[model samples]
Target: MEMTDLRLVVATGALAAVAAAGAVAVWRRRPRPGVPLRAGAVLLAELLLVTAVALVVNRAEGFYPTWAALAQDGTTAHRPPATPGRLDATIRRLAADPDLPIAVPWRPPSLAASPGGGATVAVPAGYLRHPSWRYPAVLVLSSPADGWTDARMLTAARQDAPTAVVVAVRAAPDLDPGVLATGMPLDLQRDLRVTGHRWGLVASDHVRRSARDVAGRDPGRFPAPVIAAGPGPSGLATGLRAVAGQLPAPLAAPAPVLAPSAAAHQVGRHRPPAHGPVSGIGLRHGP
Candidate 1:
């Protein structure tokens, strides 16, 4: 088993043992009511406790197995460097496979100073074959709680609009390794997505840089008129990008869809032009 799985197993076993012991102690102390009823109550309580503990541990350790598998593999060591030949070949192979979406790690030289390393890019169909065709790109800012994943973005894009090149960037840097063992609640982590360490400005810059790099590498494959988008906290970043007019040439026009109040507030404050350069049509609700 993987180390994460093993650690989870051990932690679960220990918690179960402790719960069992506690239940037994409670039963012995007050042998009132039916035994089955008492046992059921104990089991329910233990189950809830276990779930709470597991969530805490998962957050603290950054041990989300699903996310770790996808994001970690995109690092420089694992993924081949992006080159025209390699990119074309990979895209061709992926295009042949009906099941695989064209999303992959984007590690252009411009992203060397990025706070969260690199972003994930999802290419549209026929991207490999049409070297002369240029398509609009969208930068997706992700919530720190769930982070960003190519599969998640691709799935969402397929359901909504599958034409543009969608880029999902991580909004937060790595959490402190020492915080993993703390007994803090998961709500704290959620709060940290916004309050503790703000990533709005940095994330916006990352989006700009990503769009520029993609256009620079394959000007004909990915072109101007890039859009900025996100959901929830990430949506806030999108709004910032739109308000600042950070997108490349042929800017997207539609305003990013934010919460009703936030959307109103931003529109009121920024008064973005009716025909602005950032497209924000697909983000009607939270992700």
Candidate 2:
């Protein structure tokens, strides 16, 4: 949720409390005959007042992106910044390529089964070109909104001890909200399912297929036996959490890292070689 929205909620709650107290005070002093009705009337009025307050609050905070227009003026002009990463750059290039292969040689390599019986797709740095498996892979779900750009993504892979791979499912175009509401948590799995149905596949059935496609298309890009996985804001833990239901084993929870560890060293170990360079991933777009 946006900080502004949170403040509004808090303010509305406070107003509701104050209004309720006032209603009770008014009830205590009312004459006896229609006391019950008087109390009910006051309570109803309070409720209406609270609702009005909440609507005004919503209008001010602009929490609902689709319906609320009051705050749209402030947000419409902003564009998210982009970062470069090898994978992000590759994905962006792939998205932009008019002549991209209708059928890229995609295959599903067997992934390490999560304890929950679902498979995890990992995209390590330079899975396309890097030789050393010395970069940490990030497990992303949907694409990063801002900081997790292609360049930034690649930079993360290059800079980290173990390169990162984004973990995400493709979604239907209709599912793209353009701008998500401030407080609504994204459910990529459901969105992907809806998106898959649009593509003429069963939603649940296609997740595995998508994962397989990711694995088959890029082998050895994701290092098997993951050292540590970090979830980015949208993609990380949430994506893993969604996939857990389908994983073969329980996925290990990520640990907080103040700094890179031995595994981080392992992921970045190959940068000294000619094929390896300690830099962020390349990108194809200016955005």
Candidate 3:
């Protein structure tokens, strides 16, 4: 059973036990007229207490059922299949087509068994013409409910600033599939988005591998010191990766952007700052 279901079950059992105990206590009182009312009050208070405790525990465990339905709604929207070797072929084609405008949309690579199933990569402007130019890479994590597309990343890239490749990783894998399958009511699924599987470490590895693969295919197109960024839940993941020394570039994002909480910032503060040439364009938050 899912954590939420399990918690509910346990709470129900606790409530039953409390009711039974109250009944027994009242029986032992031996015919006192007020005993029934006292027992009912005791049972009601115990039930509420159990429910409150369950809610608190569920929140602490990050088991938000409300957002699950919304997340499910967006999960299957327009995910193009990534056939084997297709990514490499696409990159080569883009490189060869030097005359093609950078504004054109490039297909994202299909990540193998990725927590989010796949990732969207946005190449920098002039990538086709500047064969020898090495650009920094940025990995942007997306929210579980609303996945990002390569076009979104391209829009976020600055035209005047030094161009860098942007990769947006989806949070689909981090969400619980069970909740999606059940088709839970909208009201119940309206809480907050919960983290199902712990995909942080594995997802980071996938990002590094992706970076290496991109750099390897085009020779000098992408370089080291990748910047990890995001907003909302993904932003928190990005900050955690930065704090853990996974990202070699300093974390940067606009003030209005949803950065990691103060506690997360504290964790990242103690770690050594990422080293390398910082990108002129940091994290940009928008639609």
Candidate 4:
């Protein structure tokens, strides 16, 4: 069974409960060989309890994403990296498969200086449903200490717009805005349908200056960033577009084509990557 499987944790906990009950029953009855029977039951219960706790913690935190990670110091991801040049090919193959979404570990060399190594693109909800559609993209730049989890980003993606793709990354003091403005989209363009050259940005107050620098590096590409303060946002994007805890509204039109303008461009003339991502990472609802 997978180490992070919730079913295994529940089953082990149930067995521990049964063993504990057996120990209690044995003590009350004081049956023949009472000491040994109670001791054996108690020991079994303790072992099972410990096992259950370990499984629960592993599942919750993903300490060891797989058996290989456990053998090592957990540096490896749950999935293996694609072959050097076959990365794009692998992405295309998976893109054809019917999957809800993809959130692979994106650690390209160009943006190595950025905090958190790299950022993961949180694909929009009902992504597979609109196979022909390309999404409006947003880069959510949080401070290094923001603790922006994948689950939280997923929630923000859903809130932002069921159609808008969200990229969550932490901004470091020394991070190069020019590299972020240039490299990340290129890397993502390989796997995602962020068709238009431009992208919207959402930044927390702590990273406001960094966000501005990123936006200024490429005015046509980055545009004005929405400066958000804590849960409440107050910045350039005004009125309905700047809704709190969500991304700006992509369109004022009645129709729901998130990227109507970018529709003309063919996603940098590349096919979309598989929504399921490569073999290593499975789609999870929460972090």
- The TM-score values for the models, in the order shown, are 0.32, 0.28, 0.29, 0.48
| Comparing 1 and 4 on lDDT, the stronger one | 4
Ranking by TM-score: 4, 1, 3, 2
In Å, residue 277's CA in model 2 sits off its true spot by 27
- Candidate 4 similarity to native, TM-score: 0.48
Best by lDDT: 4
Which ranges of candidate 3 are over 4 A from the true structure?
1-89, 92-110, 158-162, 173-287
Off by over 4 Å in 2: 1-4, 30-41, 45-149, 161-287
Candidate 4 lDDT over 1-287, as tens digits, reads 44554457789999989988887777778345557777887898889989888887665444443344466544533322221122334444555443444454567554565556777666654454444444557777776466566666665555443456667777777776655664455455535544444567877778888788777654555655777755433221221134322322222121211121242343344433444222222222221
lDDT of 3 at 55: 56
- Backbone clash numbers for all candidates listed: 3, 55, 4, 4
State candidate 3's TM-score.
Answer: 0.29
Q: 1 or 4, which is superior by TM-score?
A: 4
Best by TM-score: 4
The per-prediction CA RMSD against the true structure, in angstroms, equals 18.5, 19.1, 16.2, 19.8
Candidate 3 C-alpha lDDT tens digits along 172-227: 43443323212111111121111111111212332444334333322211223233
